[model samples]
Target: MSRFELLVRGGTLVVPYVGTIRADLAVAGGRVAAIGLDIPVSDAATVLDATGKLVFPGAVDAHFHLGIYRPLSVDAAEETRSSLVGGATTVLSYFRTGQHYLNKTGPYETIFPEVLSSVAGHAWTDYGFHLAPMDTAQVREVPSLVEQSGVSSFKYYMFYKGFNLSADSRDAKAFTMSDEYDLGHLYQLMEAVAEAGRSADRRVSLSLHCEQAELMRLFIDRVRADGDPQTLKAYSDARPPLTERVAIGEATTLARATGCAVNLLHLSSGEALAAAREARAAMPGVDMRFEVTLHHLCLSYDELDGLGAKVNPPIRSHADTEALWDGILDGTIGWVASDHACCLEAEKGDELWPALPGFGGTALLYPILLSEGMHKRGLSPTRVAELVSANPARAYGLDGRKGNLLVGYDADLTIVDPDLEQEVTTDLLLSGQDHCPFEGRKVRGWPVATVLRGRIAYQNGQVVGSPTGQFVAR
Candidate 1:
């Protein structure tokens, strides 16, 4: 038999398509070399006894925002480490040009290098980027970004037209995407993206942040006018389920008109899923895909009050959460992500009415979901792998390469003690943000050892390897 670099001894390798069984997974040159029982370890360079562990393919987080929430140089590396601990071996973060990233100027030509520089050698696992087109210049640069930056995925923020380019200090209400002229320009950019995608055999998928801007502005006005702080449901009542439904319909219509593939981000309500279903059924060429966050699956609008759960489109009702769970089991929901945007406690506590749109939950995702999703909810372990790893990889074109435990796949794997129990604690987390909404929440199943490219990057509670995470060129 051929010699191997490392051998994972005596674990039941759980490949989704292939049934689970006892096997020894061998690795060399960062790819799976062999799998069978009782491989003699005398010839191997290193060995891991995964005797009682559920060895799973490392997760591929399809949606992540590296530099947007904070600086890439300072925050991206740290955040990537948090992802590593949670078993995400590969992360696809979205970046846009302008002030929020670094207060920079010029097109992507000027902005791309600075973004790359900030994240150099700072991740424990591999990484990729998705660029959001904010202007005509970026729309034109899509093909080059795909070829050079290896970014095949792009984003379209429906509600942040003018606000996207402006700094946070500026009055966002004054420069919203609802400005009629800018909305038209945004559609033009979308059309350009559609055309660009045609040439690249792999259709460049556009991720849409679907929220109707005008309706949101109107609802916020009515809510503040009513001025009831205790009505935690007010946030959801304001950005009602209909709002997401409307935007989803608009996104699919645009996709059909332009011949582009659309992927809706962080959909929280039942109405939104219904719209996506309608689009797929109606539009012949429109490849419409949508996803819901793990937080949405596990939490609801009533559990933590409005602000704590005040994510965009909101946490929604119990009915909506149940619908999301159903979608996960049925496979209509493409993937499950963290949608983790960590805002400081002080920052998140700015106002009672409308502080900001998000909160941090990166470290809490896996344990919370595994505990609640599998243990409490009775979802099969097979379903967990599909939602967390396999489906996300396939959706983003990183399938066999990153999501599955197959020969020729990257040696990115997670070792989880399936029966381990733990409570969510901010102190133990590796995130740059200090607090999480899920603190004190208990969950079963935890990843103890995370391997990235055959290197032990995160084990127990500490990062073991250098942040030499390569820029994965898709």
Candidate 2:
């Protein structure tokens, strides 16, 4: 028997907050056992020769929707399989008691367990959930959710207050199926999370989807009334950056008031990023972190051709994309995520108004950052590692166990061929979704292998085995 179960030899390890270094990584019992020079290849049972590749921590894709459109078990199987291609070993997906997911409303005591049961055996990556407390009853569950269920994070959709954008209806109840999911409910949720944080040693935080509902109602009405263009630009106009700014103010004000740590999720526009920065400056004492998504950083309504690129807090102009990249380069943005919701083409049809928002980009996580961010924008490999991996792990309470390629951490890493370039296609991503929003674009820095818990989950552009992914406590 060998001392190490697996060894990745001759690679440059990109460690977040610490720069890159040449090292041989050894794994034992699913945790990183050693990282140093001259670990003989014969000592390991399995060895992967990574002579010239860059090895990075497997990304913790913080924003995901495992079952938003499809059934829980199915998304668990297919979406997570897609995650492997992206070099994400762990995924923290969002769940809510609403119309699309499970299509029913109930206390998480029952619903959460059922959700867990449905996805338990189907996933191909370690997973956790960031639940939305849609009603007061669910808000009451926050304490137990944090302590017992190991759910350190919660969510509140700022735009789901009084409107249902999905159905183009004013009644949010038509979609949320909850009781008055407005600012008041958000306050209670924050209060619960804040209070819960007092007891837990780890962070107990709330994530807000910051798009104001009333503003959306007004703009949507105006857009529809003024000869709706039926383009991505029209979608962007309907739900402009103004909504994000106002919602940031509303959410951050409450975050400051309740003393709750908050994450401003998927800030889509330059205006939105500016508002978040202003809020951070004003409330220096509050713990607020900002996030940008891959689509927001690269794709814009002007550049993207079809409705497949349509997403909530709609993809902005090229200026907004550059602004977000500025945020990333300047340290204003801590992390980037895919905001991956596996919506198929049939769901996203020809009509922009009724088409579902969001498409899968998880598989392009490393590829895009490496291609555009590093290769074009001069983003350092170390910062790229932090943006995709470490920062997200710290934000959502998976830091010590999952983020770095250090001794005693989970041996979750990806070996990348930094020079390998390939065009984006639905077939390449291995997702269940039939069409890809980012097709035809060329990307470099492809991951040759992705290891989850010291086991090779994906290698040589193929998934390695059956679903061995386990549920992460936090």
Candidate 3:
């Protein structure tokens, strides 16, 4: 019998917060057992020759929407398969009792179990849920969810406060399906989260989608009254940076009052980044971390005219995109994520107003960061790994097991060819979504093989085996 189950030989390992090191890694029983030079190839049952590649820790895609637009089982099957293409081994998806997901309001005890059952056998990546407490009843379930169910993170959509986006629906309540989803609800939710954090060993935090809805209503009315050009620019105008700025103020103020740890999700504009900095200065007592998505750092309204590019805190100008890059480099941003939601083309039709916001990008998570951030912008491989892998894992409670190429961690990683180049295409992504907003952009650095739990799950652009993904408890 072989000493090691699998061996990956001669690759540069991107260790988060640590410099890249040239080494060979051995895996036994789905865990990294050793990392050194020149272990005998005959000692391993299976060996992958990775002489010229870079080995990165499989990304923990922190923000994802599984089954948001499709059936849960179908999404769990296809979307997580797509995740393997990008070297993502785990997905922490957000679930709430809302209009799009399951389309009902109920207890997390019943609803969360159902969500789990639906995704159980269908998944291709290890997964967990950040369940949102939309109503007061659910708010009381926070401690139980954190302690028993191993769900420590929650989300609040500040944009759903008073502003309604639907053409047919009259009120925001129709979308949220909750009782009073205002600052009052958020306040109570924060207090509950803070108390839960104090009692639990894991970190309990609230992630806010920081775009002020009342200001959105005002700007939306103004945009409609004027020419109201049907473009991405118009969409950006309708939901400007001021909304995000104000929302940050409100959210942080409440976080300070409640002593709740908060994460500001998808800061889209330069002004929004500035506002987050200001909040950090003012509320020094409150714990706050900032997240920037792939699209916010790369895509811009000024360049991408497609309506499918429309997203919450709508894509800002190219200047704003550069500003976000500055935040990433200067250390203001805690982590980068895909915020990957697989919205199909039919869902994001020609109309900008009624169009769905997100598109699939999990397949491009590591690729784009390596191409645009490392190759183009001179971000170190270690820093790139930190943004996509280690930092998010530490923040979202998947820290020790999933983040880096550390001994005793899960043997989840990808072997990347540093010079591999390809144009972006929906087919290349292997997602259920039929269209890609980043369709034509050329990218360098692609994963030649992705290994999940000591097994090659994806190689040469195809999923290699059956679904062996287990649900992550935390």
Candidate 4:
């Protein structure tokens, strides 16, 4: 038998927190075995020449939504294929017992297993889930879910308390399965996370969607009555930054009291970013991390094409976009993610109010960062690696094996050719969803290949190998 399974030779490796170095990486048994110059080709089964390419640890996308808007099996196959093409080898998606996702109200004891079984053999990349307890019964299952299910993170949707997807409804109970998503329930959820952390083998975190429901409802009514319902600005005006700010304050306060680690997801506005900073200062001991989405970083409301850019916590102005970049530069933002939901074009109608929020961008994950952060903004390759790979791995409890380009870690990597430039188009994307909000835009830097567990899964904008992904236990 060969001593090494594969060798990636003559590449510029982007090591997190360390400067880039030219090295040859050896892989055996699906993990990085060695890193040095001129490993003997006789010892490996295959050699891939990576000359003139930038080799980065494959991105760990921490905030993905696969089965939420579509079938889990289909979403896993298609979206993860797109994610791999974009250089993400592993995806940690959020799943909950809700009206849209599993479409049931019950204990996770039955539901989570069904969720796991549904995507058992379908994904093209390694995958895990962060679950939300939508009711009291599900909340009581947190400890077991952590210990047995290998789920170390939980979610709280702050805007689902009494809000509706459309402007006409008054109650969110049918959607969330409970009327208890208020502050008291949030406190209890934090307490449960704290309790789980005491015995969990890894860190446990509570990820929150921090938009205040009552405030959003009021604003939505006013916007519907007074504003143009067809424009992206109207959506932004409806769920303004103050709503996110208030909810951030409330979440961090409860987190400080419960001593639970908290992650603020998809922060989109200047006011929200400022409030997140204040919350961190107020609770210096509480573990808190912030995430920004690709849409927030790349496009603002004034620049959007249509209602397809309408996401929850809607995109803000140019000033807010600048604020997000500042946060990323100053190290206040821990990571950037796609918040990728494969909402179809038909679902996103011309009308803004009824249009479904969220569109897939997993295929643009690394390209956008490479274009804006490295080519345009002067961010170093090291910082870009951390923003996409290392920070998210550390934040979401995947640091043991998923993040860095170190020996004994999974040999998951993406090779990018910085000189390759391409325009964003729907046909170029591998996602099942047909429309891209960023269509026709040009971006520099692109992924040339992706490796998962020493197997080449994507190369030259195509999926090259069979699905070799497994459930990643935290």
TM-scores of all models?
0.92, 0.98, 0.97, 0.97
TM-score of candidate 1 versus the correct structure, residues matched by position? 0.92
Q: Output the better candidate (1/4) by TM-score.
A: 4
lDDT of each: 0.74, 0.91, 0.89, 0.87
Supply the global lDDT for candidate 4. Answer: 0.87
Tens digits of per-residue lDDT for model 1, 228-287: 454447777777778788888777887777777778998888888887777788886777
Model 4 over residues 229-278: C-alpha lDDT tens digits? Answer: 67778888888999999999999999999999999999999899999999
Name the weakest run of 10 consecutive residues (lDDT summed) in model 4: 168-177
How are the candidates ranked when ordered by lDDT, highest leading?
A: 2, 3, 4, 1
lDDT of 3 by residue, 226-335 (tens): 88777888888988999999999999999999989999999999999999999998878889999999999889987889888877878889999999999998889988
**Ten contiguous residues minimizing lDDT sum, candidate 2:** 170-179
Report per-prediction Cα RMSD to one decimal.
2.8, 1.6, 1.6, 1.7
Badly placed stretches (over 4 Å) of model 1 are: 161-183, 201-203, 228-232, 306-308
lDDT of 2 at 225: 88
Backbone Cα, N, C clashes tallied per candidate: 0, 0, 0, 0
Comparison by TM-score, 2 against 4, better one:
2
